[model samples]
Target: MRRIAVLLPLLAIGVLAGCGGSSSSTAKPVVKVSGAFGQPPTIKIPAEKAGGSLTVKTLIHGTGPVLQRTDAFVGNYAIYIWSGTSHRLAQSSFTAHRPTLFAGQLLPGLETALIGQKMGSRVLAVIPPKDGFGTSGNPQAGVKPTDTLVFVVDMMKDFKANASATGTAESNGGKGLPTVTAVNGAAPTIKMPTSKPPATLVTRTLIKGSGPAVTKGQMVVAQYVGAIWSTGKVFDASWNRHQPFNFTIGATPTQVIAGWDKGLLGQTVGSRVMLVVPPADGYGKSGSPQAGIKGTDTLVFVVDVLGAFST
Candidate 1:
């Protein structure tokens, strides 16, 4: 969960956004499912069918805001491969996770299931092969391209965009860890450290925010640039991606390295902070070659805290 993750086909709608939703309307249901969201639902998989269109059925109605096509959404969802070994459960976000989903980031069939649905609503959707992974299946999740993907999505919250952090320029040399520099409101850059790595996590606030305080379990949205202390070369950066990434500070699953969980906790949103992580708090002795990191290497990061939300 540290780097950009490869989501299973059913959970891989992370690129952009799209539109569509399950409604109480003229569309007919081809598959029937029982039970509810929050608890595993009983699904009666439909007989194999040729390529077709998408369908939807609402098991629980909600009274929250109607999800719009352009809005960003976060929620818990479950996916089952239809017409396979007795409705195989493929993926789920119901356990210790909160995924950030937005328009254009969703598959066509999934877009339809999300729109028009209100927060707290649970939806059952049937996606034909054309609307799903198509002919080339997701081998990681065992979709064979011909597989039909079924989803039971739990609409959660629509996160409002957070204003980026703002502050005056300060001398970069006073910090005990790494020196940080920022352009005219651009992402901050880290000047690598020449000193031996700290034995524990080190946190220093370069800029402060007035927004809400970040708690331990709340999902944190931040833009960050990470580099190896030994070389001071960048390995990963959300700034380069032009988007912020988030993690549960100290949560069990999908939580980031220990340095982040400890460094950013209690910091207010819209703040800018730096983390100097020892090997123990970072990628550990094995290190991450993918990031050009070594076992004994330390890690440095300049993180811009953007937003925090609980899904």
Candidate 2:
């Protein structure tokens, strides 16, 4: 794990503050960042130390949605610790081949730099101690209380908690599967029948999306509801939490259940899919007792594919 990942946790939430000092007399720091959007940037720190305040510079302007305090976004970013005459690279989501989710509260300087920026823009932020990890610094990340931090962020995609599938409905022909009632921008309702659940896995597309088909090894954002077929009781739902689930599809060792890996592949973004998962592809014979699922019970799920990003 990257050192910053250990300290920041990516989706941290906290107070929001604007870039730069509160006083007009404060001068903007001279930090140079040069690179193409979507690639790692080359940063050159000034020989002189920066002012005792946050500084923000937009390296590239994007035309996408303007981000808000409560909005969420995917970004390819790199962090460097600037120690006056020298700097050290701390972390880079671009190098890891995975974009990061920036939402809720972040490092005050980071949030300030990103909040008003447009999606697809590249932003650079120089964060002083007060706007970063505070006076305690992040010793584990080699950051001293006196050191300033630099961030280069490439905003890739923006999304909201209520994001859902958008596409034309496809008829299922009443194939004896569970029925699903989905409304755009709202949580879906699913009803199961008393008939015996399918013994094998069943993948059905309830809505055909216009976006690209999902590929293996891509970061996927989705909203879903899972229920036991036998009892028709809801066991889990991302909608209830008001946050979409993010996972790397087909990642080694797996980031989700086997059924999800099998069912989501090839599904297009914005499509709503239904998967009837048998034990072998689900929680297996052990089942998920905490979720009210039995050893032999089958699982039914309706999932909305919100977004997909290549690693």
**Candidate models: Cα lDDT each:** 0.68, 0.79
Candidate 2: regions farther than 4 A off: 1-29, 47-50, 83-85, 139-147, 172-174
- What is the lDDT, from 0 to 100, of the residue 161 in candidate 2? 78
Report the poorest 10 consecutive residues by lDDT, candidate 1: 16-25
Model 2's C-alpha root-mean-square deviation from the true structure amounts to: 4.2
What clash pairs does model 2 have? 13-105
> Which tens-of-lDDT digit does each residue in 56-131 have in candidate 1?
7778998888887665556667677765434577776765366554523576677777777888788877776666
Task: Please name the candidate that would achieve the greatest lDDT relative to the true structure.
Answer: 2
Clashes of 1: 12
- Give the number of the best model, judged by TM-score: 2
Query: In terms of TM-score, how similar is model 2 to the real structure?
Result: 0.85
Predictions: Cα RMSD each: 5.7, 4.2
User: Which residue segments of model 1 deviate by more than 4 Å?
Assistant: 1-26, 30-51, 56-73, 84-91, 95-105, 111-125, 139-146, 152-173, 183-185, 192-199, 252-255, 309-311
Taking all chains together, each candidate's TM-score versus the true structure is 0.66, 0.85
